[model samples]
Structure formats: C-alpha cells, structure tokens
Target: MQLTNHDAANPSYWQARWREGRTGWDLGGVHPLFSELMQEAHAAGLKPNARVIEPGCGRAHTGAALAKMNYIVTAFDVSKEAVDAAKVLYANETKLELVVADLFALPSNWSNSFDAVYDRAVLCALPQASRPSYVHACAKILKTGGLFLSIPFTKLHISASEGPPFAVDEANLESLFEADFEKVCHIEKQHSVKDSKIACEMLIVWRKK
Candidate 1:
C-alpha cells in the first residue's frame, strides 16, 4: 500500500487508503511491546474488566487482544473500511465495539470514558503540525489518572523521500504529553521493520494527572 498525493491529516484520505488496501501501518497483529505491557499490568493486579480505548485503531488488533483479556474495549478509527473490518473480525465478541470516527472529533459519549488508552501508530501518523491537538484530544477522552500507553518512532534515520512512520524524538513526545499526564515510564527498544534503517523506538506510559 503506497500513499499518493493525499493529505495525511484528512480522514477521507485515510478512509480511501483503507478501502484501497493501502494500510502500510497495519502490523497484522498486536504489538509485542503492548502485549508485554498488558501482561505486566495484569501481573500487578490491574482489573481485567477495565475500560480500554484505542484511537487510530487501524484494524483494532490491540483492542481485540484486550477484549480477550476481559476488557471492555471501545476502539475508533478515521477510516470506515478499517472500522468495518474490525467489527467483522471481532463480531461475536461482545467485549469489543468498533466505531468509524476521527480521533480529534471523538464521539461525545466517549468523553472521560476510558480507564486506559492505547496509542500504537496514532501519534506519529498525524502530521507534526497536528500533534498538539491530537495529544489534547487523547487527554480529553481519558479519565483523570487514567493510563496511557504509546509506542512512537524515535531517533530513526530516514530519507526525506519516505515517511508516515515519522521520526519523533523524546523531547517532542515529552512536551506533548507532559501538560496532561505525568510520565511514569519510558522504555526504548531496537525493532526492525522491512526497508527501514530505524531499529530503535520508544514506548512510554503515563498517568493522567
């Protein structure tokens, strides 16, 4: 799936991409880091029925994983095709609900509705100019003291020619979340993705404060 002249910030562009099967961002499964983090959270006695929300939930794989663990999961994506695919994939699983909606304009019913939020490719998917509002919307939808888990691309060398897996350094990420949440943990790992030289990325956890 390749991007053309589409505007990255537009929901219609993303919807069209999904319909056209141009989802380069889809990992085909839940992220390993998120699986590990959820396991650790469970080990530490976090309730299995916690309300979880995932924005930009491409195919909603993470939400499906959480639902399997007994979470009340609600996931939304800007692409109708993506959301519809998720609904069909998770259909018979009462624990998961998928919605087609833009992250910044989340449904009013979701305000302060989640106990935890997962952001996999969401933050970096936005154009850098829209990041502040994107972060703000994430904060707005979370309950006070709610948990946030994010995996963002970091310190990656990329040619000006390729992107959408944009580079986001630690400082910019910190500045984005600091105002709305207290940083709890930040972990860096080396991961390999085909055709990309970037092997190091960051996973951050924050508690809404």
Candidate 2:
C-alpha cells in the first residue's frame, strides 16, 4: 500500500487511492457524529430542505444521510471514481446529487448558493498550505449567515509531509475562518478512527458573518 505520491492536494493522489481500493477512511455509512450534529444544526434553526453541500464527499454516506433527513444535498469530490461510486451507491436518493468538481474551482453559479457546508475531514485531507484556500472556497459558496460544520482531527502526531489526516486543532481552525465566520459552537468527541495519535475530533460549527 505504498503510494508514490504523498501529495494530498492533488486529485490524482486520491484517484490513485480509490483505484487501488485503499480507502480506509470510508465508514460504510453515515458517521456516528452526524446525527447529533444534525440535531444541533436543527436546534439552531437549520431546517429541512436547506441547501447543504459536502466537499470531498467520498462515498457520500453523510450526504445520503442528509438527503434522507429531507435536506437538499450536493456532494462533490475531486475523484471521478469516487463521485461515480457515490452516485451509484445512493442512486435512489433523489435529493442527493453527486458531482466531480474541484473544491477550489466550484461552478460560479454555486457562489453563495449553499445554506451550509459539511466538511468532514476535508480540511485535514488537504496540505496545510491549502487551508486558507479551502476555507475561502467553503465560505464563498455559502450565503451570508450560512453554517459551516466541520469535524477535524486533533492531536495528530504526523506532520504534513508524512500525509493526511493532518493535525488540525482549535487554534488552527480559528486562525483560518475567524475573519469571515463567527464560532457558534465547539464540541470535542472521541474519534471513530482507531489511531492512537488522533486523540479526538472537534466538531466546530461556524456561522458566516
């Protein structure tokens, strides 16, 4: 399972991982944290039928779950294989639309079109240098006062050069999005991943300013 490239920012790196069937990150279903987060969002006035988007939606299990919960979901991935597979897996979910699109270059028509963005590890999957751009893109697609829900790994021992999931802590998150988003909530929960180096995941909800 040795990959020649460790470049997380490149789509080809992820495409190759899928081609090799090396996606250990796929949870096979919606993440355990999603239901509770949805509840929190709902309590915060995020209603059903809201336009929700998931960036780097691998397999789109969460996206499908959102669709099942009656939200309009648009999930996109850089890898065509990932998007195609997700589309097939959730074929019956009419409210869920999966597309292959670069997160940094999303369609112009999508600007300020989303009510919320679900970023499950998408930020950690990217190189650290790309975090600013990643946050900018997410903020760009969201309407004013829209939500940004993120579940990022914390206390990861590995460096960016070692590979993702990269270490992203509360400070790291605030540094990137504080300019455009206001922190609404931050909850720390045990990670589903088995790695010891990953202490936990921080579920941060930010409202666009």
For model 2, what is the alpha-carbon lDDT of residue 110?
Answer: 97
RMSD of each: 2.5, 1.9
Question: Which candidate number has the best lDDT?
Answer: 2
Model 2 poorest 10 in a row by lDDT: 1-10
lDDT of 2 by residue, 110-167 (tens): 9999999998878888878888999999999999989998778876766656667787
Number of colliding residue pairs in model 2: 0
Tell me the deviation in Å of residue 148 in model 2.
0.6
Residue 50 shift from truth in candidate 2, angstroms: 0.3
lDDT of 1: 0.78
Off by over 4 Å in 1: 1-6, 40-45, 192-197
Highest TM-score among the candidates is held by which one?
2
Tens digit of lDDT per residue, candidate 1, span 1-209?
Answer: 55553267767668777877988777787876776677545543357899988898988999898898899999888877898888888887789988888887777888888888888887777777788898888788888978888778886676423556567888988888899998877778776444364667777788888
| lDDT, model 1, position 172 | 87
Task: Record all residue pairs in model 1 with backbone atoms less than 3 Å apart, i.e. clashing.
Answer: none
